[model samples]
Target: MSRLDVTTSVPVFTRPLRSTCRGVPASEAPPLSSAASLVGQQVGHFRLLRELGRGSLGVVLLAEHALIQKRVAIQVLHAHVTQDPARVARFLQAARTLTLIQDAHIVSLYDLGMRDGRPFLIMEYLEGQSLAAFAKGPLAPALVVDLLTQVCDALGAAHAHGIAHGSLNPTSIFLVPDAKGRQHVKLLDFGIAGLLPPSEGAADSPVAADLFAVGVLGALLVTGRLPSRGHAAEEPLHGHAWEVPPLPSDLRSALSRVLLKAMARRPVDRYASAAGLRDALHASVALDGGAAPPESLGLERLPGWYALRGPPGVAPASR
Candidate 1:
């Protein structure tokens, strides 16, 4: 393994590394830690400023373009993980997948390149936190519909391109403010979960799995927690024996039905596509008066919505 020379402020990569195994080239071997050590180093044209966060697959860094000076988020694959050819291929495939899908609700991929034999992705830098932060408690029904509709649109666009997000957890669902200070949804880590080795008895297909996750997200938004997993005494309308959490008393029956269908144990019973799920959500909300318009749901009026934007005088970065 090649170690990064950290004697100075910026770490520099050392050359002439040993081969991982017989016949494997030195360049193909995994390098040293690529996260904190590379803070002041240059990856492609971007200069890493600080570490944003770390995940199972890679480290996300806050970086700035050398020439243009534009701020961006860079996801650098852990050098150790590159030992597996399959994982490396999947990581590159994820970058290609992001480049193929373009939607306002999906995080934009600015560039992709190799740094010291490791793959890195340059993406739009978001100033807001993930949906998980704000979803600690039940959100307003109107707000939920508004936010999720954007998510559905993003997923629908990906599905059209023959790509499934496969991963739709709250952490991957980010919430940023638009120019007008309205909450906006930006789905992150598209096609990432598929990059991992498949688990036993996973969903039959990626599309089905994505829809199931959407249902789980819906339940979380409505109840501020995941639905309990257990056999219900009575079978659900979809003929599945699973427990469904009771919605708030104020919620209308139409929305309740929508939740049930989206969360059906059998994929055949769930919404056929993300668009279908989105339409059902809109229709359900419409039946009970109408959902509030986007402009009306400004983040300024909502508590904790501006938490990620920093203190009062700070303006959010442009997307």
Candidate 2:
């Protein structure tokens, strides 16, 4: 048998940082499309709670460490997907890579191993809302800066480790409220994390893949817009898509210039690094704040920083 080599400009190192995640199905596969029954089962040392979400790689269930009582999000692979030896190897590789990453903003992986012929991961259970779950609307520029600043920290950490979150969608960015009642942003998902030495990448480079997406994410979150990243040499997006809605004209202009540059088609044209992008955000916030970002999210002025209306679908969970 032959192995399928990952054909990319960058090459990822396959090594284990912790217990690798491996999966393989038994003679017969269980029914999928429906949640696997483990709502009351014990996985490793964690007790399964309920299903929170699902993705191409696995289903994420909210769980709690039996002894520590710490909350966690568990990702369990589908039995069928794990049947192939190569897929099992890839899943293990991904788990190892994710474990090596120690980013506060990135969802933390507490543990990972095989169970019930499926691979599973015990991760930091975050109380936050995905950028996907929210409707982009008016937000205080300063608040935007704060959230993006946190994202920059996580991205910077990942970049330092040579990991580029292969898929950085709006849902990847989660906003959880802190004890102080302020929103804290967390970057999630590393299933397709490109932690490799690549020869070529999205738009001709590796580092730029996530940077481009981050810019688009910024635009989408700040304004209800889509594909902030520009089109090909043929046509460009100018006041098209959902961006045509009514917004403070100046606010529109500011995001336009900033996000446009970040989403430049060429990697060289985008922010050099996540840190650079963060700096750009800082500068933009300063400029936009010709007036201060409202005291908080669209709320009337308050005496101090506020507990802003979170992105939709994220009502603060009582602690």
**What is the lDDT for 27 in model 1?**
45
What TM-score does candidate 1 get on C-alpha atoms?
Answer: 0.76
lDDT of each: 0.59, 0.52
RMSD of each: 10.6, 10.5
Tens-place lDDT digits, model 2, residues 205-230: 44576666666555655554532122
- C-alpha RMSD of candidate 1: 10.6
Question: Residue-wise lDDT of candidate 1 within 1-319, one digit each (tens)?
Answer: 0011111121111111122111223343234265767788766556779977665667777777678786666667777767777767776776666666657777545655665667766565646645555454666667777877888888888788777776566556666666766677767666566455553345446776677667656665677553222222111112222234567666667877787787777778888888888888899887977866777653433432221221121011111
For residue 62, give model 1's deviation from the true position in Å. 1.8
Model 2: per-residue Cα lDDT at residue 222: 54
Clash counts for the predictions, in order: 0, 10
Candidate 1 clashing pairs, residues 3+ apart or interchain:
none
Q: Roughly what TM-score does model 2 have, to 2 decimal places? A: 0.69
Estimate candidate 2's alpha-carbon lDDT, on a 0 to 1 scale: 0.52
